[model samples]
Target: METSLEEDSRTKEFDGVIFGASDQVFSRYEDSSTEVTYTYILQTAGEFGCFQRILVALTFIPNILSAFFMLGGTFMLKMQPHHCNTDWLLAIQPNLTMSQLFNLTLPRKKDGSFEECRMYTPVQWDFDSIVKYGLNDTQDCQNGWFYLSHEWSLITEFDLVCNKASERLRAYCIFVAGLFCGSLLVGTLCDRIGRYKSILLMLMFYAVFGLGAAFVPTFSIYQMFQFGIGIAIMGYTISSISLVIEWLVSSRRVHAIVLAQCFLVLGHLVLSVLSASIPHWRLLHLVGSIPVIFLVSYIWLLPESPLWLMMRGNVEKAKFLLCRAASINKRIIPPELLQKLTNEKIHQGTIMDILKSPNLRRRTLILSYVWLCIGLGYVGLSSQLHKFPINMNGSHLAFRLVEVPARLCSIISMEKLGRRKSQVLALLLGGLTCLYSAFIPEDLTSITTTLALMGQIGLSAAFTIACIFSAELFPTGLRQVGLSFVSLSYSIGVIGTLLIESLDHDHPETFMTVCGIMTTVGGLLCILLPKG
Candidate 1:
């Protein structure tokens, strides 16, 4: 049934919008209409009191756990110390020690690290003839490699170095591809299923695929698992974020977004520490999957988004969620008030709805460009964190651990500066810092590292605010689709990680400068979006 708001909307002369806006942005300001109307859940129901605080926590904590799985592939696939086994030399001389066997079979680099891919060809089996030759003639490793560590990685197990070195990077790319495919499916599907159920399903699959990857007998099987985890990771993230967003007042929206990010970074820190301490890569994968399984019980605690339930014309379901929220917050919603609740009269959204409108299309296009830029810039900066100067163990962990506060600061700036201004500030500053950091001399490592961290702070804040603002641009029905669409740019940005690494081999600054330029362009385009 249409609400009193819909009946009122019909009676009044509508102006300025035709396609649609999300419930949050679906405002009509008419010259003849001196009176105002509010039919949104936030208007009738409570926001930002104890109920919403609890809502945001429940939705975001699972999202944080999902972040742990996102980077598991990176650590699990890491290159370990390895070299040609050179077992043939043992057959020739069984008495030789391992160090002696290596010195006789492998060539040394300038600083004395053994060449991993090459071994000296043996012309004679006798020790005297071998000593006379002095290890000159070399051939690529014919025998399999012997990894230094007791634990095995994809690199060590598959011999992913040298000829197969490029293959090692494939897992990261495939993981991202899985994310893209998931984003494509989730936005529409989650909109069909309620957010609460969708998240539970995602968590279930996240655990399933993560465990499968941990014990897969072959790389092909592992790839299948990695792809599914990608879908689960992104589906849980966007849906949870959208779920929390629908519950908040505009002022609390910033906190909701950044606080979730803080959890994600915290999860990353925990994953890094776990990976470092774990003896086996498979064990690390198992560890990453376990926490998500434990978190699945949160389904009973989480509520479906009332705003979404209402948008889908499920008024009864919406009422149930609202009443539950009110009771949990120690407040009461009178039955009479809920009796007034009604769904807005709007057509269901599809991808065509986004493309068919001129104003929305323009705004979505601009936001999309910024999303792509933000994605690339963020990934580019992250790819460089290992270069940061530090004397401590787990220095990469230290670099990531500090991002929590950077995300926290966005809560203040997002409100104070407003969405558009903060985005512009972050993008501009982040781009400039990345450009400058790229040129700093290696000798000035501390100074250069500081510049990168500053870049992360700016870019991270920009990325966070950009998402909240993007959701605001679309109506509830298409908000997930819109978020998913724009976030595909982020998946596309994962390619930048590969590009930067490839370019790092020769023209190190090329990709960094490219990231700077992209972000700068994005900041300029973000100015064209309506201020949220």
Candidate 2:
């Protein structure tokens, strides 16, 4: 009996050892599985992080290039001579036809001995002498002791005045119409289509219209081209701004847009040099078109906005694109995170939706007024570059240079201080300066000039702030629409140019009254806008 009991105990001990060994092996296997899973997760995360970085790089490079192209022409236009070139005269003249002679005719004497024969028959005739002596002599001789040709002078004066007035009217009309249509058209289109498509379309329009403007022969044709250019500008400006804001994380959006405007100033500076060098308006237009061609190459490079795609119910496509972006930026997006991103709700908005929402309606109204103010203060002021007391080209260059630092200051302040405070202060100060400009004594015109400079600085800052703040107010879905609407307000501001242009510089009050009212009204409206 004792031997049997001892055998049972030995068997139990062996069984216990086998059970312990099996359990130990299973625990080791489980740990190895967990280690493998962790390694895979780390690797995936690193890849996604890299993808995100790539997306940012891809988005930023094109935007920089686009900004360069859009502002290039305007800068060039501002820098070119306000007066017509005399170079054309050197090519054809002095081989006069009867018609040409009639075009250049002096009056006939009653005795037909060339009323003042000495003036008509030059002593030393070169091209320079002909220009200096011929036209002046002919007009003067015709005026005195001859047929009054009051009819001719009246016709010539009427024609010259009519042509100039038409040109000015056309420029302002195109600018205003383009601003309005661009905002409305681009805003609506971007909502229906995607951001990428809208951009591509706008770029095409820019390239085509820009080229057309460069080559058009008639003033009427040129006005049409300007209208086209305006449309293209409005479309691209609103969409590009909205896209940039949407793509960046909230913390960085305002700084990015402000910095982008700084690049715009840089573009203006570059254009100033190009305009000074090129001299021909057509060539300047051609230069603007060249940069836009690069945008086509980005067709494969740029991705559609994931948020936009998602809102449109393109979940799978959005996921794929987002994954690709994440891959490019090298962000490690995990399966669970990807799932969460896919499940997230997106607002698929319409224009009616924008109008219907009370919050948005109020926001839109304030933004429109702000837009008007910007158009008036910024565009109105900038457009008067030609009318400045200094050389037009020199003033343009100076203004471009000043804008650079002002934009830089705006960027720094926007980040450090926030959008509302910066804009309100800037606009109010700018308006007050404009008002005070009215009171500046003519003898102290130098002081007025100095104050004008100060006002410019403030106005530039205010403009920059307005763009930054407007961009921040809307959600991604309505961002483009919001910007477009705001852009329309800018068009309304262009009317101020007509008002400015009508003012006689000698009566500084005319300029002061209009500008002061605009700046002050703009500043006041800005106060009501929501703090972004």
Candidate 3:
């Protein structure tokens, strides 16, 4: 029985060897061996490597230019003078009876002119003096000059709050809308054409519309121009993030992206200083538009992402870029390895893909909510600085300035600790700080103000982290769409600002309460985000 089993095993082994040899030969003859085809294509594609390096350098040009333009407008608007000194002093004018002031300031309706003739209400020095001295009418009051005319007062009042708030809201809405729309359009175009081309298009938009915004004669026209600026900003935001992510090594991707965000904070800080110093909205807008000229250089200098090219089945372009990268990094690419490059065909996913996969769906939902909260809460809070315990304009500018270092800290910590941990911690801290701020007694003192500011700092850090994390969570193919969708939440939040009362003295508590609640909810939602 043992001898029969041995014979059977030997016969089986011999047949297997014969079949394997025949299969190999057949595959070679049919050109059906995937390994061979992969190698052949890689060799051909590797020849054009030098061209890729040039394109990578070009990408940063447009981003920097776009940043300058977007932030410049913020600075200009911040600096523009609105409130007059006379209004506040006039309200508290001493030694004047209320009726006497009305009679002195009342304008004559006939021919719509002001007459010098004025009247004063009866006044006595004291009740006892009037009874005892039979009214001492000998007291002469010096004739006071009218420092502010009724017309000037009316114009000043119009400029003080009503007109200013309307203009600001209009500008803010236009800017946010343009940014959201532009990002979506640019993101889609990036997928269709290439990163470099999308950036060039954004730069053109920025140069034209951004500069035009600075010269708009009326507030309404300015808002329209700002909408154009928004479009350019949206285009730059989507394309720059995509292009930067594609060019860097996988290990460096997070670091590079966070660093780019740090620059965003820096842009804000720069705007703060410029806005504080310039004191004119239009000039600030002009300064913002100036950087766009730098972007024109990108038209000649930038390169398309090799990864994007590879995904599109442009093997030759990918090889050319990779080889160029290798040369720039001073690393050798093995010819044999180069010969192995081949495209893997991946299905282009629709927006539905984001919702179809459970894990992806959870991520998208959480991210979108967090993004919405960040946009609404942070921007709403920033916009409401006019209603804070501090001076509105000064606090608004200062808050922006404070974000610079906060963003730097976030960039450093995000890379060191990883995206998930940093984001969670930021949200947690922000929420707790916000909650703490609510209990602080109003009119408390410097301590309360400090705590409120600290809470703001925490919220700002969380916001910065959300932008970075959202970019990191989505895969490259759907990144722009994912970002745009999340950004749309921000615009939704901006609209919420209108519903809330923003008058500093009358409704401070209401604004603060709303901000605190929004920030807390945003932070809580942030905790559920998946580990990236």
Candidate 4:
């Protein structure tokens, strides 16, 4: 039997007793069972009322802070221009001008620039003997390197140069590895402990670990803190999105998600400004994390998802929250409706439930792969922004600004073209643009950068569309687990991007080709998903 919304009727019998639309209740009965969905109850709660707005504002502020954890590495890990530390020459000759010091102490490159990794062997001699002998003996850098730029970044402070240059890439991988581990662990944690609690816990973890990363005495400790921060971030992301979706009605979900993403983009832009203003990596890390420490106040102001409570069989708490929502929404929930909720039963979701159903299993696999591809493209492109012809800061800002229009376009496309078609189109656009850019000569910086940014627009939009689509595709019971798998796949892609980036310095074409193929294939796979 089917139940349809009827404005004229207050009660209906569809082979069994059911409520009307005005009650914001819909019930179905089969031989021995009565079923109710949270969606029906959420309608009465006033989806986007003041309560939801406040929740969104409180929950998403951390997303702005996420920008620091996510992209701050680009600025903080950068290696500035440097040459071997030749201060030894000063001890031998007190009056050697800086020019003469470099001319004798370091070897020159073909372009007449001093070699960054090599210095002339030191030999004790008077000033006139050194001038007559013309010290030409060359050897590897004997002491630490001297940075031409004053920026105090990870590279400069840690001396991650020459033999240690590869360590920088390793640190990046460690951070991404944390994201992967965190996604899987926290994804389950949120489902088990409840979204609100999970969020609060992760917020504390993120702030603590983030601040620790700034003050760590060694590179290894810093890496450990980075991993912890990554886990916290993934936990926060999964919990917040789940909470927001559970709170809002279906009609307003897209708006809420896109709005949150807008906040994230805003964070990225602000991060660019902050990076420029604060060149020291430690200070930057400290500044970025201190604000999040204050957000712990969300414990008092924010409410747990009523739907999660109901799912957990805490009917009383769910009811109280819903009643509060109704009061705030300026709506009423009848005693009968409340009674119906009390009688409702929901099974806790588990990984097995996702695999037990063929439809769900198929959707999960497809969504995971699609998310992986989107992650690969988005992260790869963003990481390469510095390689463009423009200065690093300008390119970073440009890349983030491009996301604003891309996200708006995603919203419009989701509205006009529908989710499936819009996502497919976006992915294909990104892949095809990247393919073209791959063959373009490196000297054509203008054309290459233009193409990369165009591809970013497509990938960025695809990412936003995919987030909403994945959430809707999974059943409410399995949403957390399903999204966890999807997020896990995205983490894999991000890790893949980091590994691929190491090869990028030597094989640029290979990097672009792989991204293009992954994205294009991901778009095509979406066709396999069931239509909305």
Q: Write the per-residue lDDT of candidate 2 for residues 1-532, one digit (tens) a residue.
A: 3446554543322112111221211111113332233224334444325543454444444443344344443443232111111222324554655433433344455785333321242233456566555655432221222222222221122222322434555565765687689888987787789888887787787677766666665556666766777777778777666665445544455566666677677666666676567654556667755776776776776667655665666767766865565556656466674554443444444555567556567767887876676667666566656556776557777876787788789877766666766787777777778788778776785687677777788888988888877765654455666777777778887766556656655564676556777777777776665554
What overall lDDT goes with each candidate model? Answer: 0.73, 0.59, 0.57, 0.80
Predicted model with the maximum TM-score: 4
- By lDDT, the candidates rank as 4, 1, 2, 3
Better of 2 and 3 by TM-score: 2
Give lDDT for model 1: 0.73
Candidates arranged by TM-score, highest first: 4, 1, 2, 3
- Candidate 4 per-residue lDDT, tens place, 10-118, comes to 1222112223432211223211132334556667667688878888888889999887788888899887899898888789788888788888888889998889899
The TM-score of predicted model 2 comes to 0.72
Off by over 4 Å in 3: 1-103, 106-165, 387-398, 415-417, 501-506
Residue clash pairs of candidate 1: 22-475
Error of 2 at 294 (Å): 2.5
* C-alpha RMSD values across all candidates: 4.8, 18.2, 13.3, 6.3
Tens digits of per-residue lDDT for model 3, 296-353: 6776667677657765788788777666666655556677776565676333444565
- Using Cα atoms with residue i matched to residue i, what is each candidate's TM-score against the true structure? 0.89, 0.72, 0.71, 0.91
Residue 117 error, candidate 1, Å: 1.1
Whole-model alpha-carbon lDDT for candidate 3: 0.57
- In model 2, where do residues sit more than 4 Å from their true spots? 1-162, 343-345, 442-445, 504-508
| Per-residue alpha-carbon lDDT of candidate 1 for residues 287-332, written as tens digits (9 for 90 to 100) | 7667766776776778887767766788788788777777767677
